[model samples]
Target chain A: MSECCGTTATIEAPVEPRVAGRIRTVALVGPPNSGKSTLFNRLTGLRQKVANYPGVTVEQRVGRLNGIGRGDLTLIDLPGIYGLDSYSEDARVAVDVLHGEMPGTPAPDAILLVLDSLQLRRQLMLAAPVLNLGLPTLVLLNMSDLMEARGGRVDTLALAQELGVPVAKISATRGAGLDAITHFLNRKAEAEKPVPAEGRIELPVMGNPRSYRQWATGISTRTKYKAPLSNEWTKRIDGVLLHRIWGPLIFLVVVFAVFQVVFSIGQPLSDAFGEVLNAGGGRIGALLGHGWVESLLIDGVWRGVASVLVFLPQILLLFLFIGVLEDSGYLARAALIADRVMRSIGLNGKAFIPLLSAYACAVPAIMATRTIENKRDRFATILVAPFMTCSARLPIYMLMIAAFIPNTPLLGDFFGLRAAVMLSLYVLGFVAALGTAWLLKSSILKASSAPFILELPQYRLPTVRSLSLRLVDRGKVFLRQAGTVILAVTIVLWILSHIPFHADLAGSVIGRLGQLVEPVIKPLGFNWKIGIGLLTSVLAREVIVGTLGTLYGADPATQSLGLQAALRHDLTLGGAMALVVFFAFAMQCTSTIAIVRRETNSWRWPAVQFAYMSVLAYVAALATNQAILHFVH
Target chain B: MVAIALLSDFGVEEADELDLSGAWKLRQLSELPIGTVGVVESLDLPGEIQHHLMHMGFMPEARVMVVRRAPAGDPTVYSIDGFEVALRRDTAGAIRVREYEGQNTRQG
Candidate 1:
């Protein structure tokens, strides 16, 4: 039947037209890994921000769906949630948004309920509660391709009749049968009955989960929907990949390979990127001539932005691997293997993925901690997430290792002494994360963690489209940071270092400030110049390299004389090691602090985190410096 | 002898009564022989943990089978409701299970 001529169209609309001139908001909701994101991407395509894991998308991503009859249809992709009663942050956000209680967001005009076709009955439990909201809703039975491939059946027509809503079978990943949903949406938009009528079929209150399951099962049986068994191929793969002995071994190798690839692959790309950026900056400087304006443009802006961009290669590789791992469902298996280690630190297994991601970048990692259901555990994870060796620290670590550690092959030419030193720094970050988490869990946030119950989605090949989109989105974030926060910090630092028009940097404002702090940090074997780098690095850890580059009177972008050469000329071995240790323990990223504030919804925690990390950094650096100097003497 | 020792570690007093025919015994889901189908008897975890597990399709009558365990033997994968879920041994220990009596056991 046509949507307008359907029996439900007979009732007179009692509610005001919600789509007058204002944009209509439609929310796409579903269970985890049910292809909700794929459908959202298909509907909104490329005009969306993607966060892969469930409960991690704290920021509500509203994308524009054009030509949907509603003048401007805003499609909000809510985080995948199992049900309304769960205590996960995503559930609360979903409930709050549906109730129009979330500030700055109105309740959705309609809900696009996505369900996994193979697991209809299980997913239907979520649909029941959503139906009770009385919103204009349509169900999309997604993954129908997999369903048919596995000899399963889902009668969309029968399901529509039973649920009293429009239903369409779609394979979101393959982009099949999406037009039907678009047509249904257009019809709903034209119907003028935005608000559901009181006589609409009431969804049974899902007070007893067993009863809800029975109800869902009854509906499915009548429709002749027999859920196919788990794929034999998946079982065979899991048998080996998740094997008791081999699983952990493979996980370690996989993680080790990721880091190896990041450094091995990323270094060359980063060097090439640096060379191009430096060439560009040098060309711009030559064109503009050598004045204060040229200096500010080249030394301040260009170099500052380059410092951020140089890490792009590493960041890209990291996210690419993470996207593949996450989409393939191996991350859940990895988490299972790490659960023992996680519990020892008073964290659940789910925290492992986020902690692992922190090695690439802490910003996304902090955001990824939302999947931890317990507030206390989530908080503990977020606070320590920054301690992981992020890609931003790569430049500084590489610089230090190059200057201090020899490149002689230690274990064959594949593993050099420098590589071991780099690995040790990463290990230090991990140990710090675990130790800090243990202390915080045992002392401050003493509440017990929620049980680790992770649903392992079927492993599948991730589409190139989603992977590229992820890479592009992450690239955009890095560029945005380089443009805004990093730019501002660079300009301010440039002015401070060049103020009073002083030819000698020692007499500049920043130089004076560094001198004042020099005595305090002298025990750590840092001079005033090193002190300034430490101060500026608070904006971003990479800024320390740029700050030092400028301090030593070298072009920061060109790496003229190279950073390692300059550091080796200026810093003692003990001082260089101390600086590395300091950066390792310090919470140097303002962006990380801002995210921590937003995620925890409290400035107090960020303040505590910053203070604690600073103290720890200072003490660790001091001890390392003293021990090294003592041994040398 | 090793299998018997491990079975005894499960403290299944009635392990002898089960025909010694390789029919699974009553044991914690963590100790349950992997690949052996069993019905969820009860979840003895703390209230919040129990509630969270129940919400995730682990009701009283649900049939769960161990799929695999990690190398550490701490988190084991279980298949139920036609989907796989990984649970830590500590959390899995809270749930008690009884082996399916026959091959025709009802699926969840």
Candidate 2:
């Protein structure tokens, strides 16, 4: 169902008249790890995204699986939800899709209740409710392979008799029984005869009572077993990774290693991407003849959008590895270990994931904070999330670190000790996040946090196709967002810096404004050009690089290659450090701010977030400026 | 002596290995006879199962019956808060324990 994106269908508006009446669509809904995703993957083959994390799969994925030997079929994979009592957007989306709550999102024709046969009855806990929802449901008894491997068995015949639905058993991972499953779906899709699912589950006897007992009947007859489980590699790895003392230390070290890889390995890739963008633009510019048309094509759209995309590989590499760690389930153990430590600092252990995300981009990181229930804690989390020193800061970090922070002998002792300087920036970000969270709790969002609770899914292999598709989709969103806001701001800043200007480029209106502002920032050692770039960065951080690329009289595509040399030869020791401090504090991305407004459901907090973080940046940069001058000058 | 009628994510090396046979209230799954009965104060896990169970108002007072444990010792099926849920023994271990009586059991 998610595969339908970017298809360029050419079918008319609203899903086409020819396709609408005959279209057969089913949505797979279940709890995380009940194997809904595995079923979706199996059903759609490689034509979809697999969501294996809690609170991800924020949007419903649509994919089409047509001509199953009978007719066409379509499947939409809704987010992994807990229940109809939806709390988060992920859960709400699931409910909303089921009810056709959003415009143009038609209600699914049927629901496939994907259940882990090992936990068959609990799977029914979700299944029965959907049945109660009156949607015709087909319970796919998934993970049957696990049942066999573990020596557990399900009475499929009895269960089907009990639920009165045609049950199809399949092991979604190894792709067994898929043909039969698809055939059954094909039958349902093609046949006009209404085979309504039979169920209004009676709740089992319990101390608590609610009539009709949809919950109770599910409890009464189901069976499960106690089994010994041993996987040597996991135990061995968990030795250090989940160790009582060293676990968190190892997690920190692993996280730091990833950052080092992103910062260092990403450089050459970024350089290569710059060349491609430049060549592509220059050829197009020549063809079009340089004018506003050429400028819009080369500089306005292509160069502007491509510059942000050059960072994609870095962001992808980061998110890909993060996804793997999460899928492998090491993240849960890390969370458990970190919980003891993070809880002390007034943040939930779960906040660690979003905080880590802040390194790639704060927009999603802030959105990811929804998993935290305590409003105050969640807000505090969002407040500090920006400080995590995301990938946006990488170019700036690489430039400044290469220029000012010379490699210590300790760096050569290990891989990229230059990474340590960047690592310290992350630590600084955390400190700022916590400091601000503490301040916010005491002042404005001053309420206690709900206790953090989460179930850790067992480790499993993450499918690459789904993960990559997800990266492309997310990167597309990031590019789209960065392009729109940055283009408009870049032109505006260009006008601001270039107009009512002197004959020379440096004396342009934007330059004079920077010059006027440079004195205020001089304590922080910023020159007017740096000031202008910093000002332009608020619309988008990538723009700061472009602003520099343009201010240095080089287009971003061509100019990025010599940035290290340029900054190194040009910037004073204090000047480089001060620039780092400024980037560290500035409210650099507008998408992040927009997300904040939506998440908080008010403009007030986003406004406050901007003011407070900016003030923190200014003060921090000034102090760093004074300290660097004292030491080196 | 407490014999764990082990319904665990880990298979029992011996049958009825966990001595959980007792009338345990819903609050005592963690501390009851190592494994006779199961108590579910809350299904606070991350997924939809937890969400549904909570919506059914299954909380601190709901009693559960620790039904059969598979030979492989996974997904210990139990009746709780008027609903049945199967849990990996690893998840069950995370539950807090208390004392229980025989009549408190929903499943004989």
Candidate 3:
């Protein structure tokens, strides 16, 4: 039994006439797990636009209230945050947007403060500071359906009286009680008189969490709030899922299943996609037959764009799984389980999801680092993500292993040499990532103390609409990158290789540049043609195979041989092994570099990452080649 | 105060051993067994972490139940104010709590 403090007396006067103006922009603010995003999707449907805030990686999502009968009313979904205190980047962004301090974002004329009714006693702590902002505020108790079903109770009329604002208990998931929002907006838009602030309860001291909690507890008691019982299924599931013995084992199984789906199923889908694109490009090329325009359009732009687009299936598959894990709240449990292992490497448990996703593509994985709250930990994770041996490295590894390693059985026909080499390459990338993370944590990016505070939200079934929206958004990001940066790089490479028009492959500008760098790579057992492959592979790690195929096809001496035969004839055992090793460690994907730059909001990080990884790759490959040569001699 | 006099009669002399209400003994949150509830007394952590934990419903007088330990047993989950949150052993050790004596086992 605590009494309301004295701060709310300042707002006891009638709401100013300007405050009742038509609500053009509404901001949705709430803590994590409050179902704020779900309500946003419900109100806006398919009309949301997601972008980053000015000069920050935090996402700024704004959409129109199409379902609320006011298609012109804009709703800005600020990042979910615990408090307005700016300890993290997300909270800072939310604070800026609410106060109209952020550039390129209109000031929210009203605020929709959504809280979980089941946890209103705790969540109501946010209402005090927010109400102090003096914007026309509506407190939306989301998840009220689940709350009531679990025996929770709340007196919305009494609560609204206490806070001096409208309170609506609605379930965003069930689409129940949503007409309250429309009614509120319509009434506010038509009303022009001053709103009398009667029955205004006192607020706690600003920025003091203890006083806020006491104030919240007093309000809850007065409102007769009854919190729901803990979900029985969540407890039972955690008893097994977080068990000492079963938890880690199940985590392994889940991770294995994710990768198996992404590769075993997604690979065939991607291959089919690639084939379809190639066939379509060929048909278009035949219409404009035999000219530089055909070559540029078909071989340069079409092939490059198609190769990047082919990854859409695998990226979507990875995101589908990520979306499910995230929406169902299993991602938090996974982070808790992974905290120990990740902490040993100087990263947080939340880093595990992004690192796990890096095996598919670093672009999405880097984007996934937004879940990490600490800026240092997020940056460290982003810098090391590209070393996780993504799918792009598979083609080069497969080609080299096929040309070099024999299929000799190592252990009674169970494991072959080729499989051993491939596994070793995977191991190499993981080790490099771990070692680099350790180095960074010990030196430049060291935090004063590691603070990992994660809330384990109650599990729920993921919605199909939410998952599909996630996939659509991810597909858009991947395609936009391919159409811009990848397309530009492809056009530039095409022009350089065809300089002095119709020149032989050896006499082109790119070939001369490759020969110019031949002396540097000779120590690693690479020829000038391999140097050219290295240069082209900077566009994408998988592009090396196509570059080698084209370069060797253009040579009269090796034209009669198959691509694999030509590679085997030109490269020694040491060089072939070194080539795969180089691909294993190098940061060769421009997509990853571009994403890293965008995520870090500076080129310094990607530049440093590229340089460090390249040096390491060169040194490792040199050791690999010289050691094999010495042993052979 | 009554419990303090009763404890004094049993030869316990340290006033610091009891919380302000003298109904329960004060201990670090990590020392509490699973299923046992405690009222948070104070936080001895750094400023940012302390604020964050408080924002997460770890304020003074808030009842928190030790739910379960992670698989490796370093971080433990605690239920506070109708929600569950996980904290590492070091962080939990900084939170001072008094063993709760209320009959409502599930209510926070």
Candidate 4:
């Protein structure tokens, strides 16, 4: 009975007739680690759009199916879920979208269910619920290449009969056997006949996982599906990677290498990018001939944009390393290694990834918290993520350390006083994050207990296409920030500084506001100039470097000196130390604040977060400045 | 000691059973040594977590093997239904498993 109809005819005959343009949306759904994302990337290439679902942080990724010569078709990649039961927010959104009940998303006309063939017995459990939805579905057995290599066997024709759906074997990573997808869609295009009642398979009791599992097991047995032999490499690798001693030792080394690369390689690349932007701005400014328009466009707009844009290299590099770690399955191992430490701080091991990535930038790091299933744990992670000392804090820390700290050797030639201070600042930020997480977890956001259930995926080599796509996505997000919030803030600062049409630097509107703020920061040993930097840095943490550069450049006494020399001449040792300390603890970046608002979906959390961090920063800076002053005297 | 108590309790429940040779023992999943194989008997966790574990192929009668443990030795990895899942000791303690004699039980 299963072999009576050919695969092509069976798939084409069931799709319900809709108007030509109405058959536009197709949903791609699968359980986690089923190669669903790899398939999505293969199908969509560069035409994907990522956004959040209405009023929630769950990402909605839709792309044009142009790779298969179907530009008219849209593929909506739903979140990877175990079942359609609404136990989590991800499941709820997936359920809503599939039922066409989601507010803004179009209901999918068909479904592409990707399941890992190596684990087909367990994965087949999902097929029952999805097939019951009555949408035209194509069951794609992804990783079929690996399955075959490992001596796993599956009779697709028989399996298709058991599920009453079309089943195709394809390796998403290898980009092989994808023509079946195009064929299915092409037939779906010309499919005008209504689905026959006899085509439906007898599904298990809905919403019961035990019944689903039993039903799935029976199907696999009848279809003669053989489970693949466990991959030997994975077991051998885990022996060393998860060893009692060697695992943690290797994890530390990997983390240290990532930061070292970000500073050693990424910094020089950023400096070169900065120089190019500067030279381009110079040429454009010379064309305008030293007028207010030139200053507004070059110094005000271009400089501000360029300052933030220069960090793109470091950000992309960090994201590249993170993407590789994630794709190759090493990140999950790292999380496992870090689980005990995280649990002590009232967070799950999954929270470790976001906090680790927070060292790059807090925006994406906050977005990464969506993987943490517990709401309180997720929120607590987000609240402390910005304290991890992002790359944006590097410029101010370097400037302060270079000006204030002498190059005295601390550990022979291997470590010096300056390096020690830099390391201490990093440690300080991490300690603050841990402490804050503990407080939040123990206080209002406390839960009964958050369970940690992590699935460790088989290790695979990271693909070049996937890594490049990740870098491109991250680069786009960073550039968008530079173009929008940072650009607007720069333009506004320029306008304020030039309000009287030709006012002196000290007498401008922003300058007056800086003087007004000086009294509040006086206890922390900061002057009006540092006051201005602090105010502008609320828009972006690194803008302080640019603000200070402009302020000191306008001062005739320090105009000839480099920024480090000018900073040394103007600031006391205590004030300079206090400045970096303030940055280390404060939530200053507008981008971080905006992302927090979007992620938490309320102003209350970000508002409380900002106020608490600012208070902590103020007290810490005051204590640092006053202690240094007293000790020196 | 706790494993023995749990085994005796299960023995009372299966009093009518024919396999009275003491070849099978009931224990928490966490008590199983690395490379040991067992069948899931029940999950005593809370509602949401139990449902989630079941969805991840931890239903009763499924075969699960202890694969490895993390470096810090808290979350142990178990192979169930052709995939590896790591559960902390506390979560693992909530799962009851039936370990039969002559099964794979390699000592670590």
Q: Rate the local accuracy (lDDT) of all candidates.
A: 0.76, 0.61, 0.86, 0.85
The CAPRI quality class of candidate 2 comes to incorrect
Deviation of model 3 at A15, angstroms:
21
DockQ of each: 0.35, 0.10, 0.44, 0.46
TM-score of chain A of 2: 0.77
Best candidate, lDDT? 3
Q: Which window of 10 residues has the lowest lDDT sum in candidate 1 chain B? A: B7-16
lDDT of 1 by residue, A1-633 (tens): 233332332112332324422225788899877888777767876666433223343656767775233335678888788777656667788888777666655567788999998888778878888887777788889988888888888777887877888888888878888788677666675664554454555466565665666667667776778787678888787777778777778888998898788778887888899899999999999999989999999988898778767777767877888789888888877777788888888987778878877877787677667657677888999998999988889889988888888899999989998898888888998898889998998898997646677888888998998888778776776666667767788799889888879545768888899999999999998988899888888878988876787777643533466767877777788889899999999999877776677677667999999999999999999999999999976
Candidate 3 wrong stretches, greater than 4 Å: A1-19, A194-199, B1-23, B100-108
Evaluated with TM-score, which candidate comes out highest? 3
Q: Once model 1 is optimally superposed onto the true structure by TM-score, how far is the C-alpha of residue A89 displaced, in angstroms?
A: 2.4
lDDT of 4 by residue, A188-307 (tens): 666655333535577899999988987887888888898888888998998898889899999999988987897789889999999999999999999999889998999899987887
What candidate 2 gets wrong by more than 4 Å, as runs, is: A1-23, A41-58, A66-74, A86-93, A189-241, A245-253, A360-382, A391-427, A440-449, A491-509, A512-527, A539-577, A590-608, A623-633, B1-96, B99-108
User: TM-score for model 2?
Assistant: 0.73
- Per-model TM-score versus the true fold: 0.85, 0.73, 0.93, 0.91
Worst 10 residues of 4 chain A by lDDT: A1-10
Give candidate 3's whole-model lDDT.
0.86
A-chain TM-score per prediction?
A: 0.87, 0.77, 0.95, 0.92
How high is the lDDT of residue A284 in model 1? 95
Rank candidates by TM-score, best first: 3, 4, 1, 2
